[model samples]
Target: MSVFTLTKEHLDVLEEKKLKSNLKLIEKIIRNDDFYSMDQKDMQYFLRVADVLYRYGKAIISDKEYDDKEIWYKENHPESHLYDVVQSDLRESGKTVKLPKKMLSTDKAYSKKEIEKWLDRILNTALNLNIDRDEIIIRVTPKLDGYAAYDDGSTLYTRGDGVNGQDITRAFKRGLKVTKSGKRGLGAGEIVINKKYFDKNLSEYFENSRNIQAAIIAEKNVDDKVKKAINDGACVFYPFSLIDNWTGHYKELLNDFDNIIEKIWNAVDYDVDGVILEAVDSQIKDNLGSTRKFHRWQIAFKRNDEAAEVEVVSVTPQTSRTGRVTPVAELVPTRISGATISRATVHHYKMVKSTGVGPGALLQVVRSGLVIPKIEKVIKPVEPQIPEYCPSCQSHLIWESDHLVCPNKSDCPAQTENTLVHFFKTLGNNDGFGPKNIEKLANLGVKHIHQVYDLKSHQFAMYGFGEKTSKNLYDQLQASQNIEIEDWRFLSAFGVSRLGGGNCEKLLQHYSLDNLFGASVEDIEKLDGFAKVSAEAIVEGLANIREEFFKVYNLGFNLSITPKLSEQQDSSSPIAGAIIVFTGTMLQGKRGDMEKHAKSLGAKVAKSVTGKTTYLVAGTKVGENKINGAKENGVKVLSEQEYLDLIAQ
Candidate 1:
């Protein structure tokens, strides 16, 4: 079996790479015992995959693995693109808009010596600006590990490719409040999940908080749990300006660096990967300037990964919701980095076979702060005991690529129970249908998701549930229906392959819930992100779930319909989808600012007017010939006030 399972979201990102090699080849490269001897092209492909996965929180190789490859690549090929530029986040395809301000990455420092050098640069810059070193203020704040975006009060934009980003204003519309009770338009910030809330409610369903963060900004319907978290103020847009910080002079910062870093790291409940130190003096920052990737005056301090060697007791196979069996190693209790470690995952059965990760095998494990500890290497080999049948159904297993699969998807008790559990869990408005409860019901002959929905209070009582528990379960079912949910989330709960929340929302944008089942593969492929293979899988999966989906969907739940792209394109706003050109600076804002605002409001902003121009907004210094030429082309000429008035309508 494959070591790591890639979601549709991951695949979508991979498809964009257009790599010459397939995923099978990439996995083989990752599993190779000797990375040093791999082909250069293969190594490059592996590096790209590792980079993307690391950013998405589905990192397959550890930091050391990535670093070793990177170091080797740099020494061998100094002119490679990887070394020349900063790798930006893999962005989703959408309307690209400019950020209000450039959000540059902070220069990172790993050691105290490096930090001291950075301080010298700051001091030099301070001298250049003719400011006393003692008067210079350095501010330290927790560097949040979350999705980065810019909030301009009315719109939220992803930090796409640094300068341009996709409009994610829907996050605010979904009731995501600002952290620290801060107001909007606080420039740059992160959309983060509360660590406490994630551990308690979402850890099991999602692999990491990064997954939850991505779901929040996804165009698809947000998960019910995430939606509730946003509403409860557990998830918020934490503007960097409002972050809890320690402000002190340069001397005070250097004197108590360790204590200050520790204090700021623990200051918030959000996931903080590091601490950021920046000069508060704007003049010093301007004098210091920036590189292509990072600002000169700001630096982030990151802790190193901690590793420990542990003996494996045995490897246990657990079947997941998708029928891929994961081999989890049971290790001798060993403490690593303050947390007691007893288990670590062996990526796939392929790894178990190749690496001999059997009973009594010794393994190297590393944990980076609160991140899940990963098995880095098998120190000692042992005969691997592979599973011959599905653990839950005793069905004969088969190999699908590197992963051992239980083909009994329909009848496997584990799959059915897990699917049922996922439905209610994703439907986050419900309660009492956890694993234990669902397992009990599954054992009592509840096979289908709608069957659980069909149960009454007395029926649950018949299955040996307590009277009070049965009533609560029934009430929760009612609440799941009565509480409003988005149609995209409703579709995703069906557990269809290639149709996660993101893909579901993408499809629903083009087709409504009622018409989605009937959408052909060709119809689906027409959407922006859907590739042919994914489209085929989605079409077939939808067909398989059509009956059951309609059964559950027709139960009269409160579902908000996803807005169609066509409907959005046909907006009633006067300037909606209109091509407009803004010339000369005026009183409202910068010309560039006006153009960005127009794009956010659904108007197409162009640099110059042509025959296709719908309106030409004239500012203070427009020449008479320019206005007359625009009028001659049948484009309406409007004063700045007239254009603003039209948009306000």
Candidate 2:
């Protein structure tokens, strides 16, 4: 079989655009089936041409393949203007008109770390605005995979190029109903067909729903199958506001991120690419505005879990900074998503031993929304290859639970180098203290982080750095100390076992940095969220790093102190510690603003009323049944004005 093929329909569409030359290049790429060798110009052209073909319902490749190439192109060329504009739909004939509102593309996030970074910006902005941290609400909705459209009451327009769109009002005339009997004028939405309906009724006649969508709005007469699908109410336009969604505080959103994502991903029957996350507060959204390409307040999390089975070449044991020996499986070079995969880490030596992950064993590797691949399952077994000694220092290894540990922490070259690297990396302000330089310094008798910081320009030159490089390195160390960083981040740089930035921030909320080191295990265990075992580990870890921490702390680094929770308490407020649920259309201001205000007045804002809820503040349009339900649950019901009056007093 050929490596890839373009359908006759796809070729005809390309030929209509006078893209015969582009088609020759595309055909050559298909025959080659190698994206690595494609030049930048060729890659960009292929993407544009592929986009046009896909929009016209004559796709030349699967969505995953196209998305992979797009991601690869973006990573390689971030400055390209190709992604700045929305992908245009080139219908054969239509007089384009300006859309009622601009339809910008969503900014994409691939991992939880990126999402957290996005949320951090929101939190920081809220802090600057004096908004309560608990008041920020995040909304998650499924990102529909369908033809993009805009319905402004009367006209149904395509998202042609985000600014101007073609009027496809003939779609409504052809009996395309709003999804769930939802009314028009709901703004931005997508034209989608129900998955089950399409599979059961239209799949045999039409290749896919995209083809049917294209036919529904064809300048020519609509196809019989497409018309029937629309008439049967199986296909409709779904507005963004009418979709099923999950809403909660930022903490609950992050704490149950996986479950929320799963729940919203399958909430609708339409095809979903991912989930959309955005801050619901108008103040926060307005403060965090938009770029030309997309809104800063909104991000789409695309989960790409592509798996490929490949044979393992070998298993190698590498020691981490914490002296935990990790089993890394070297694999026969394979492509799982867009990136090449040569190695993946086994969870531990136990997995390697039990699963027999050795040379020539077949394993399934999945790129689960990550740059790095992970072993999903073992397909074929072979004799296990477990290491008895550390590869770097030749230290005797001991089994600690499921992991092998190298006990030579005081002198293990790998451990010392990795620890030094982690410290500088976590500091995130300096550039010259990477692994190569740290490893070079380690070889030259520099064993600790303090020793690296203590090196002078002449000492660095003596340690084998060039004259200019030595001066730059010394200056960077001084700069790293002077830049103001968060205390939690600084504490996290020490690489304690149970103290990441989140836990560090939590600990610092109750205790000052000066007093944290002196806290006992019992003291730490008393704090919320810290278990006894975690407290014990944290106490031991603090003791181990106490002396070195003070040495670095005394180095005169500028640090921003974390705010104390006690300082934010408003105990004098009437609703202090009261759980309040606000609902319906607010009159005095936005519902979000009211929630924020209530939180600032020391009330605990919740999305729904429960038995423990102190009050259900109802605004205009709230149902009587909902009010009675709260009252039946032993909750006080208050009108918007009544609640405001109480808070005022």
After the best TM-score superposition of candidate 2, give how far the Cα of residue 520 lies from its true spot, in angstroms.
Answer: 52
- Candidate 1: how large is its RMSD? 20.8
Q: Model 2, stretches more than 4 Å misplaced?
A: 24-33, 58-79, 84-92, 312-649
Expressed as tens digits, the lDDT of each residue in 1-649 for candidate 2 is: 1233567887887777656566677865544333433445567778877777777766665554566678756764443566532254444456888788878888888678889999999999899888999899999999998889999999999987776789998999999999989999999999999999999988898877888877888889988878888999988999999999999999998898889989999999998889999999998877776655578889998765778998999887777666677777788888665556777767678888999999999998766322345576899999998888877789767665577766554356767766687789889999999878987998888988788888899999998899999999999999999987878879888866677666897899898878899999899999999998778767766776687788888898898776687766568898989999999998999886787577667777776666678999999999775786586567899999999899989
Q: How good is model 1 by TM-score? A: 0.47
lDDT of each: 0.77, 0.79
- Candidate 2 achieves a global lDDT of 0.79
* lDDT against true structure, model 1: 0.77
lDDT: worst 10-residue window of model 1: 30-39
Best by TM-score: 2
Best by lDDT: 2
- Record all residue pairs in model 1 with backbone atoms less than 3 Å apart, i.e. clashing: 1-402, 1-403, 1-404, 2-402, 2-403, 3-347, 3-348
Counted clashes in each candidate structure: 7, 0
